[model samples]
Target: MGITREIGAHYVQEKGTTFTFWAPDAEQAEVVLHVNSKQTIPLQREAFGYWVGLAEDAKPGTRYTFKLDNDKEFPDPASQSQPDGVHEASEVISHTYNWTDQNWKNLPLEEYIIYELHVGTFSEEGTFEGIINKLPELKDLGITAIELMPIAQFPGERNWGYDGVYPFAAQNSYGGPEGLKKLVDACHKAGIAVVLDVVYNHLGPEGNYTSSFGPYFTEKYNTPWGAALNFDDAHSDHVRNFFIQNALMWLRDFKIDALRLDAVHAILDTGAKHFLQELQEHVNHLEQQLHKPFYLIAESDLNDVRLINPIENGGYGLAAQWMDDYHHAIHTVTTGETDGYYSDFGKPEHLVKTLKHSFIYNGMYSEYRKRTIGTDATANPAKQFVVCSQNHDQVGNRMLGERLTKLVSFEMLKPIAALVILSPYTPMLFMGEEYGEENPFQFFVSHSDKDLVEAVRKGRKEEFASFAWQGEAPDPQSEETFNNSKLQHSYTESEKQNQLRKFYKELIQLRKSVLKKLCKEQLEATLNEEETVLQFTHTSAGLRCVINFSDQPQTITGTQGWQLVLNSADTKWGGPGSDNYTSGVITLQPESVLVLQAKA
Candidate 1:
């Protein structure tokens, strides 16, 4: 194997441009080309596991794959883009599209109403082009930004994109590089920003050939998946650059507005200057150069506000982070699943704590960890945290991959969605969550090695049992599992889906209208731990939403001329029709949420 480059940004004048991969451990390595017909162009080894080649003709729009150890092919270990599905050939693409959002600035973290979805599972087509077709639908639903699950190339055609072998490559199956660009451009044109979920904690099991050429991973730390990245080990500069470069590449190459980094809690680095801090610095620079707003959303189990604190304040300076505690608190209360991490979240006091402060475990004892978990919230701003009721991880981690849609009845569902979207913090929706699709997001793997696939299946089943689940696990290798996960487009036409869609549309619009004013203010939520009643008072565009999350009919005094503007129990939300609460004090039914218009 032969190669030489430290993220070498090169340009070839003759055959377009070319990138090389070196596999010294293998007998052969070939560049599978999508130009001049699909063919494998031979790669020549040079110095130290380095491979070299030239295909100046391999410019943007050209797709190619890498063949290693003779017949075993893989997405390029260094592939920066993928437009096709994950298992297909890599493609050379150009970010040469026109962007009309020259004056479009980020709407601030507090105002964001996010919808989290998997590109493959979002629609029946389950591809980048597929999501593009539904931009209008998302826009109509009033989502400011759509957060797509990981798109990086993994072992199979379908899996949670977290097991990415090529951290840089887009999944070839989801419409490779060019296809992704089209989708992003379409999103921008429709005024909807796209935020991609990325995995930086650890690489997937198969096709992970990074360590062969460089010090990409280390045995010093271990993640649930496998070896940890060499973030703080010797020769760490190269490793750090590899990941930092990847983060930048997605922003610049894909025109992605934001990145949702998966499992940041799993990332390891003990240096004085954390890699996350360094990454944030680079993103800030890119933001300035692009003259456009950009963001970083972190997923962390640790509730330490330290992750979002400014560098000067000893923080990572992330724009926002997923508040898993919020989910734990709500889900535990409703489902009463007291196993695993839910054990610490069962008490009603946990729900009240989170509702009041956005994080219940902030600098408190955690029975699950058997220690004091989380540091104090920055008190700086709650907007730095993103709260959600459901997401890919929570749904897919289950044995049956059942969403709250199937677990909780419609009666109790609307209020939870309302609490999340209308709260003081930003909100994210899992794919198929709006319409309540019932398809299970089963675990699927497609390893080329038969033995490895068997091992994965066995391990997956054992893990599910730990969570007290039982059933015949889906064979990830089967095409049926992937097909089943695809979002059924027919649901959008059904009355329930359409009704839920409209209700969400109204919710997002209401939040935006408020964002035009209350950008950084904290509206206190007074929650009653016993009754499960929460009253929130926030000033928004000459209105105030005093919501009730209780289960019994109750009335409270209202401000003069205050009228009801929206209700979760409305006909539009597929809830039972209720009497008007448009004037004075009104009685609210069980499991209902209400928004009121206050007299100025």
Candidate 2:
């Protein structure tokens, strides 16, 4: 029997409750229910090292733990709710919910305009309920999806969610499992899909006792977090099933529309059937059963096309993957910061390559890695690449967690927004980027262990040495650091920020109404190295965007029959408002972008 049926705590009022666990290493396993009275129930060992038992009194809200080998007690590895904490008992949760999203068919991949946000910092409440109140705002902004930073249970009240230990349980601080369901249901009603970011590379350090129950992780390979999961090692089927079921739980039970797999490059697997391929197959089956679109998007830096290719084409059949080239190219060009990976990107030609080929280093020699990198991805549709101007990793990993808004000239922000939103790919906006939220998204954690806290602080400082950033690094353990990371929501009161907000809304409106229907072949770009200008034109859509990256104004010849649609230099958008054009020639202000359309 598969571990899927026998794992976790399943409750049926009439049939009592069924509790199961995978404990091959133990001679005995017992379910210790914590209720009015502690009742110890022994589980009968089944095939494939799975143990199963029936408890007459166990029901929804029943707190319990597992006693392995009839000795040490540990929280359920398949816990549905850790209402107490990671180190405490797990509570049985009912899947029954008054879901009103029965007709909520997911949007297609090309139509996805994802807004990535950390729920803990998105609002002052920092709970799932808090995010629900803000869904209509995102929907009004033309956001089709809200990609949340992980919600899996981790230690304490603060984390980026990458350190989640219990993949099955929603964080208690975030209102637990029930709260997440309410949020998902609310999102559907608001016409916004939810994309969860899940970390499968490695579990967190604290309260991670999966190894005590079974060989969940292998020492054969080392990940940045720690040891890689035992995906291709001995008893790998159980380990793989553990995570696959977790994915299913979120999709089937929580009704999540999509999952953004974090750091697939770190998930080392050498088996003939890669874990991703198998996962895709399972998700495909689920999609067919549910009659809804289910997507698996990966965050990979290896530039491997196989990760997103169809299984029939000898690939994993993922829907899309995060493409960082566009961000790196634009960041480097706007900031002129040639350090680390940005050293390979920054040129006008590089940005042009990113626009044309979907990758800047497609089979080219990378100066930073000192090696030829990336496979050809020109055959893939633009929608297969998800581009963003800013994301958590690009911002929070910095020495000061400074956003592009802090680094680039104010005039440069609009152009960056235009390129990302109008590009022939799915575009994502980091939380608070729409209105230029000035809050720094620094790396902060809430670990209880003093020694572990100190180690994390030291490690964070050392990690920035490679970036060569100047100034003192903020302490990750400091409360001030975490407090400063919260969203201000003060952009409404500022004239410049409000204009930026309006600028983003208009671009998104244009993207959905005009750009999505434009033919990919009609897109073309011309880069002027000498003038530091870029002209991107969409012939079918009768749209042309010309940007000036230089510190001084530059003249560019516009195509015949073109008229101004939007101007980055327009005074309405807080610029010098340069809108005058001499028939076929236009002078763009320093670090400004202008959009023009052919007169119908």
Candidate 3:
């Protein structure tokens, strides 16, 4: 494990750095210098499945690729940095680069405003460098943090990144490891924190060779992706250390502020002390060392508050978790569809339950499952929950991958977005939701084997067959399907898009300005079922969110002294209002929401 430099390859490791690679398939490997082909170094292979090479010359910005068989140049399966496509060589990155945000250490989870963005669809170039162009755009729109989708190595030059092959390496297509550093550095300088979305539940299908190298997977625990990681089996310490170290690398070396672990519910670990709790403990130690506020957010569907509760209080001590119930309540009520898990939701009482308590399906009989399931979330506050109307999963799981912008009218979308930004918990916006991009975010893949591609096609079809979605599923392997899902950035120019954008910015700005008190305050909310209007009065001062769900205008009498802060009905955002509004009792139009600032 300590043999990186003897072979003359440009690799270096220090207190804050470690270089890794996998290549049992290669006879001999060399790191070819991009500047001069003559300057080459050989890599040393060890008993394990790894090849090691060390050279201090491997400074950040140095371009190189491993040469297999002393002939064909292929991207490093472990390449941390790739400024070009995966087929291209890797680039060296320096964490020693200048950082500007010395004062921006920690943003409390309770006070955070999360904006989720896909690097590819966010701009035309769709690279790490490409997103630098829009940093100010996000900051100007009142976003405090930018949560990026997965950026690890995948098969093609472009993908949704769930099917990643190299969990540690940056995506070769999106400007590799160095590209990521530049993006994070730029974000910190802009005073906007960067939160990374990391997939730890399962490794992607293509370019996967972890199993051949070591006891990386277990036959004991089976995951939907394949073999689950062996957390409890023999020689599991090293395997657990691998992922734990990866988490620390992102927070310390990459200068990442927080990590959002994807599909934590799928991580089937049965150790005495769960792996999540252990990982959290290690991260806390690292956080103390770095003296920075590092956060661990999990994507869980267990409906258990123990995941977020403090360990001293008998919980895992995570910062927050993605609130699936919040999405279920809003989506089922607005869309009026009760299929699958949505069947347990859509009831007005369910919406009220989700608002008052974090979990709606807490030990209750679910009509869809025909069983009582789920645990209570009473152990944590509202800050432990992340509320959202539409996320990548809810929108992409559909047969057509239709977004809220497509399923509902402009009026409906405005209110839905209002509900997201003005809610007590942290709010998440899908990439193009602020601009109302009508493009679908369908599932796409890039597998080299033709038969495997066909298998995926069939699997996708059968997945949706049981639900309401029935249609010709997009050929995941096809380039057309991938391109179809790529967001058309020009939609931000359309009137409806512009209005939604402005409304989002206003709502976000309002959240930043006036909702400071509610961030820490926990409260219950409800809707008058008979009036078809939903209302939330936060016991914590300064927030009251009211939405008109039915297709009729309803006025509230008792709600006086309230000034309209964010209205989706403004004409600029294509609302019915002839003139923009400043203050009034919510004359809520159909499918509209009003965010009012409580009287001081």
Candidate 4:
């Protein structure tokens, strides 16, 4: 008989419960149940290194552990709930949930205005329930989708969710599996889609006992987080299935609309069928089975077009990928910071090129990397690239985790928002960016191991050595660092913040109402001779936007028979009044943007 059961603990109404584990190197395996009393059930060794057994009394809410060859006990590698912690026993969780989003279909990729947020810091409660309370506010901001950072089970009560050791288990501190389902259900009811960020490149260093079961890691390649996952090495098929199943659990069980794969550049594989291609194939099958649309987006440093290309075109066929060049070009031009990777940027023409073409360095020489980088992504559709001015990595990776609000002027912030939202691509916003929350999104952790805590502190300091940032990097192990990163949500009280929030809402509404119907191919961008002014026009919509990037007023010619629609320098958005034009010659205010449309 073919086995179609799930890899971990699965409960069937008629079959009671069955425990399946993969321990190729072990001679014996048993499921140690911690129900009312200690009970043990021996598993029969099956083909291909799988051990299968049944515990008649095992049901949901039962805590259990696995023992191999009479050795030390360990939590299930595919555990669904690690309630106590990563080092403690795993609890059996039922995949059943009273979902109200049976009719919830995913929003089109072009209409996605994603708001990326960390669950632990997005609200004062710092739990899944807390995020549900703010859904109405997010909905009012014109946010179509909310992308959550990883929620996998990490070490302690606090983490950025990247140090997750348990790939399948939801964090116990974040109200566990039950809490996550409620958040997803609530988001769907509020007409918002949820995109979950997942890490598959490497597991955390602590409480990672998957190696005890089988060859889940390979020595053939090394990642910055240590050993790379065994994708193309020996016994790699099962390892690939393990993670592929994890992806399905989120989409199938949790009803997540999309998944953002973290750091795909670190996922190395040399096999004929690349891991990504295989994953895309499986996700496609799942989409058909579920009869609902699901997306897979990747966060890769490499500007490779193969990630979003069609499978028949010899590509991975992912839905989209994060475009960091858009952020870098805009950031460097606005901030005037030339340190580190910003060395290749800092020119106004760079942003203009990014606006016209999708990438600024498509097969061009990169001084930062000392080599030619990036493939030509000109043929890709605008929606295949997700652009953002500030994300977790761009803000939190800094020595002080200062956001753009702290670095740029108030007048400059509006133009930056205009550039991102009006650009011909899907836009994402970091948490607290709409109203410009001033708190720093610093890197933080709460590991119980003192040595690991110290190592993290030292590693953070060393990582910023190349940038030559001044003061000492904040200690990642400190609780104050975590507390300080929480969002204050004070936009309603402060005038400047409320104005900024209103400005963002208007831009988002304009994007949906005007830009959504326009053709991406009809977009045109040009830079003046001095490269201080950029003029972008959409021929299909008969709309034009001109931005001045310099501190002084810039003179630019406006199109004839065009009427002003919105101006960033208008006094309504807390800026100086808009400038006037004579005979089609307009003088733009310092660091301001003007939007105009051809009169009907």
Number of the top-ranking candidate, with lDDT as the measure? 4
Clashes of each: 27, 1, 11, 0
Model 4, position 478, has a per-residue lDDT of: 88
lDDT of 3 by residue, 454-510 (tens): 888888887786578756778777787767777786544676677667788888877
TM-score of 3: 0.87
Clashing pairs in 2: 571-577
Query: Against the true structure, what is each candidate's TM-score?
Result: 0.87, 0.98, 0.87, 0.98
lDDT for model 2, please: 0.88
Backbone clash pairs for candidate 4 read: none
Better of 2 and 3 by lDDT: 2
lDDT, candidate 1, residue 470? 60
**Angstrom error at residue 357, model 3:** 0.9
For model 4, residues 330-351, the per-residue Cα lDDT tens digits are 9988998888888888888787
Model 1 lDDT at residue 15 = 48
Using TM-score as the measure, name the better of candidate 1 and candidate 3: 1
Global fold similarity of model 2 (TM-score): 0.98
lDDT of 1 by residue, 1-600 (tens): 011144421334454665665444555666777666776667777654556677656776667777666765666667766555445565665556566555555556665678888877787687888888888777878887888888888776777787787877777778766678788778778777788898888888776767656567889987887778888887676567777878888888678888988888888999888888888998888898987778898999888787788888888888988998888877876676878777787766665567557678767888879998887663647677788888877887787778887777776677677767776677888777777777877766667879888887788787776576667778877778877777775555798877876777777787777544442244545555445566665654555554454557766664457667788777778888777664566677777777766655
- lDDT digits (tens) for residues 1-600 of candidate 2: 223444789888677789888878789999999988888999999877898999988889899999988788899988989988889999988898999999998888888899999988998999999999888778878999999999999998989998899999989999888899999999989888899999888899888979888989899998787788999988888988988999988999999999999999998999899999888888998999999989999999989899999899999999999998888988888888888778888788877777778887888899899999899887888889999999999999999999988998788899999989998889999999998889899998889899999999889888876677999888877788889999997777999998888889999998988787643467898887594999888888878888888889988774567888888888888887785776788888998888888888
Cα lDDT computed for each candidate against the true fold: 0.73, 0.88, 0.73, 0.89
